[model samples]
Target: MTAYDPIELKRIRWRSRRGLLELDLVLERFFAQRFDSLSPAEIDAYKRILDLPDTDFLDVVNGKADLDDPEEAAIIEILRAV
Candidate 1:
């Protein structure tokens, strides 16, 4: 349950790759700047975020969509910062 898990991180890295160039840039910066500091819950939220389609994901990151899950919302905030 620690922040760092090599296997899960690997999967996260793969999943973070998006079809949208903007999403790719944002996620790249997010990982470079914040990945190591992510809590387990934050990481879980990010995993769910990655499940979103590219346009939906971008919309959420850009604050154009609503998320009822506060955890995912918090992760989107972090992505926005990056």
Candidate 2:
């Protein structure tokens, strides 16, 4: 077995189907949990999260985002849970 650094881990994490879809789905579920309905804005927010840099992606999960913004908070929690 080969050892992996953070870069390799991030590359694998970002490309995995589970990592991609699951993170987005988690955010969707979170939105539903909090709002009882998914808003177009929330959907867009999730899409934007998908577009963020891989390092930023990890950071968001690691509690770097400002939780006051629902979109940012949702993305962060979704990533953290995954």
Candidate 3:
């Protein structure tokens, strides 16, 4: 499996800290639980989603909306549980 470079993981972790508290908390939990095991595909999917506005990102994570790609959708499903 492809591994995230340490710098890349750091960048992702930092970005995951959203302006929205609820989203931030959920993302923190997600990282705590799953960061180590994440597939490179899942990491890339998350990077795409992270480009959304904080509110929009929260909506996606909270399942009130969806992403277009199947990889993104799969990651979002995993996110919902966290």
In terms of lDDT, which candidate is strongest?
1
**Number of the top candidate by TM-score?**
1
- In order, the Cα lDDT scores of the candidates are 0.88, 0.51, 0.86
Runs with alpha carbons beyond 4 Å of true place in candidate 3: none
TM-score of each: 0.92, 0.41, 0.91
lDDT per residue as tens, model 3, 1-82: 3567779988999988888899888888888887678888889988898899999888888778988899989888888987
Ranking by lDDT: 1, 3, 2
TM-score of 3: 0.91
lDDT tens readout by residue for model 2, 7-47 = 64344334433345544565455544642233546544555
- RMSD after Cα superposition, model 1: 1.6
Clashes of each: 0, 0, 0
- What are the runs in model 1 whose C-alpha is more than 4 Å off? 1-4
Output the better candidate (1/2) by TM-score: 1
Residue pairs with backbone overlap in model 3: none
How far is 47's C-alpha from truth in model 1 (Å)? 0.4
